[model samples]
Target: MSTSRHLSAHIDRPVREVYEYAADPLNTPKWAAGLAGSIEQVDGQWVADSPMGRITITFAERNQYGVLDHDVTLPSGETVHNPMRVLPDGDGAEIVFTVRQRAGMTDDDFARDADAVQADLHTLKQLLER
Candidate 1:
């Protein structure tokens, strides 16, 4: 059974700025609370490490509209479907984070992972706005 979690946040910046900030690999560690380091490429892919574990993000697409498709791998050796997007909201941007977990994982597991992602996003917002 696949499970999913969604999170949204509003940032006081333009969509482009938000997208740029999110797309930058070196900046990930600053925004991602659990990320200790990251390896990025121009092709839009990165491998990030944290105390819990390491995750890889492959950017499938990115545009000015603030939309991105990527995959995330958890420490439990589970690969998750992550489709993160951003939208323009007045002078700011609205970010949406979605997680799709693999079968056989408990809801509690998904919730815990989702909470971590949410916390990371909140840090991301703070980093960009500051």
Candidate 2:
């Protein structure tokens, strides 16, 4: 029971197209600044450098239902599960990202995180539409 927000962006692309592109972790850094720099597979695990130091990123197995949920383990060993999905909306698609306010997060911190997620989703839409 925490404060949560579902930030979304509408993309002018098919659901399958959006899902395929986003389901790939390599494409993350191109749009999402949260992961920052680059993502590489180290010792069979996806690792990325972030403002919070190096972190481990794991994505849910690719599926037909457009479930793009992923788990991000911070350097301090805290794991945050991010729920994301691409759903059909008319001829295009809608990308939804759920951001939940975590423990110790102040109201300002939560708002900042939500803003970041929205910007990331907007980037995704721009990338796909072009």
Candidate 3:
């Protein structure tokens, strides 16, 4: 099943700054609490380490907006899909985080994941505003 989490924040900075900050892999660890580090490749793929474990994110860019298609390998050896998008919203931007889990996961599991994504958005807002 597919589950999604969407969060919006208004930053005082221009859209370019916000979009650029979000696009840079090195800056991810600053705002995304779960992300410990990220390594980017010329092919637009990024390998990130988070608390849950490691994930490979493929990027597709269109102008200043982009989508991150993620495949996460959990400590339990289960792989999950967590695709996300960052789109320009007036002066700021909106972030949409989505996850598709295989069979056997409950709604509660998706809810927990959504909550974590929301928390990460809060952190992102804080970082950009500073």
Off by over 4 Å in 2: none
Cα-based TM-score, every candidate: 0.79, 0.97, 0.69
lDDT of all predictions, in order shown?
0.74, 0.92, 0.64
Worst lDDT run of 10 residues, candidate 3, spans 57-66
lDDT of 1: 0.74
Top-TM-score candidate index: 2
Q: Looking at model 1, which ten-residue stretch has the lowest summed lDDT? A: 34-43
Estimate the overall C-alpha local distance difference test score of candidate 2: 0.92
> Tens-digit lDDT track for model 2 on 12-77?
999999999999989989999866578999999999988679999999999999999999999989
Candidate 1's C-alpha runs over 4 A off are 34-36, 40-45, 73-78
- Write model 1 residue lDDT over 1-130, tens digit each, in one string: 4556778889998888899888766777787665445555535547777666766766655566666666666677666566788888999998998876657757787787778878888888888888
C-alpha root-mean-square deviation, each candidate: 3.0, 0.8, 3.5
- By TM-score, the candidates rank as 2, 1, 3
lDDT string, candidate 3, 1-130, tens digits: 3444554555566666766777666777777765445555545556677776666654445354556545555657766666666666777666666654457768887677667667777887788788
